[model samples]
Target: MTEPRTPKWRALADAVRRQIEDGTYPQGDALPQLKPAAEAAGVSYETMRAAYKALESEGLVRSVKRTGFLVLEAPGRRRVTRDTTVTRDPARGYIFPAAARPDEPWQVHGRPFRALVPAPAEVARHFGIEPGTETLRRRRVTSPAGEPPFQLVDTWISPAAVEDAPQVAEASTGPGGYLDRLEEAGHGPIGWEETIRARMPDREETQLLAISTAMPIVETTIVGTSAQTSRPIEVTIRVIPADRVELVSKLQRARTARWPVAPVKPT
Candidate 1:
């Protein structure tokens, strides 16, 4: 008898590629997230994740920490490399104002996008809603110009947020793109919290990210909250290829009163 089919992950990855090529998933459309796809494909979640990693290595799928996988380029789109800078200023704060409606094309030197439907568990856990609740999810890969993808980002928002901010519901063709609608609706948060972890990539991750066997992945979980209420509104997960990516943060107090009181001296 023929040897058992090469593990399910490879098969699943190939199937997704096939779907994308045949226009089943379509450009700008969300593909199924991992759990459901694994169940349908009759494989374990680990196996499913493996498949996605393979696609990622081939530059077909991108993994975001919190959001699921996303398809950045069309099935047959060509990727041309140019010397570019993937670094952002940590000390300088940049905001894409709501009114400008700036556009960033998907083919920028760094940053690739992956989109997928939310699974029931993810919807409930991430958005504080019941299973089956609807949401829009995207994962982004940001790398330094002429470097490997250094950052993986996953983002999720309630369907209501999308419905209210119709522009955000639309697929971004590039970067600094969706924030406009969120800011316009006054939903953008002033601060975010991040959690970090370190781990080695599995077989699929190793292949898809084209990472060396020795490299570890630095995983981060980020939650954005309203400046006023301090309530969490957005959650992001990012996985950085440890060899090529670095995470940077800068904190600035908004006012004097907001600063902590100093110890008193004896009168």
Candidate 2:
């Protein structure tokens, strides 16, 4: 029997994977656009697109808007080490354990974007209001230089609570950040509850994080609730690409259980 022939898309993907591994296209480098790349490989545009999709699923490359496809380089070197714990300092303001981690050099994509915008459905639900209701949304993006932008943080504040704390809407919510301000304004002793979720990102999230739609994202909604009254002060939605972060949790045993009598063996 004659040997089976490899499919065009797989062949192209394998070739590109090899090139990426061999450093032909360095990390953060954009691969050729679809038309030229497909022509060069003597494959159809659809074949090239399929190959790229496969590579994306493998976490090897990603589609970036306006920049074309980009090499992810290596996950090991880019992987961010994280701990499942929140750290805060009254003197230091936002102790960023999330994105812009202290271990690696990072840059805030831009200054915090402060605006009073209609709440997203999820955010509105958290705020106990109808969807599209006006709310104060503060946005920030943090990432390492020369890498895909990751960790888009959107903080939706309870408008009523911040009436007296005008600084909450300011460009810079002074020391200890807005949380501290809210606490000082009678929302004191803020407690946190986090709901973690994983799913494929939407178009906006994909472009913001510079990842392909094929990749999943880890979304963490950290809610700051009033410790005394149990009312949420703010809801923070944090988004990070799933392939690049290593989440660590240090679990501890609370207590030991012992049987009162000897255990019986099953037949």
Scored by lDDT, the top model is 2
TM-score per model over all chains: 0.45, 0.81
Per-residue lDDT over 181-242 for candidate 1, one digit per residue giving the tens place of the 0 to 100 score: 55556765546555668987766555455444445787666665655345555566666565
Residue 202 miss distance in model 1 (angstroms): 5.0
Residue 74, candidate 1: Cα error in Å is 28
- Candidate 2 regions off by >4 Å? 1-7, 27-30, 33-36, 39-42, 64-68, 72-85, 94-105, 144-147, 257-267
For all candidates in order, the CA lDDT equals 0.57, 0.79
> What alpha-carbon RMSD in Å does predicted model 2 have with respect to the real structure?
3.8
Tens digits of lDDT, candidate 2, 1-267: 999999889988999999998999888898889999999888889999999889999878888778788987563324445555667766766564464545567667767688889988888777788898889999988878756566788999977766857789988777888888888888788878788899889998876676778888889888888765587769998988888776765656544544465577888
Off by over 4 Å in 1: 1-116, 119-124, 131-134, 173-176, 202-204, 212-214, 227-231, 245-267
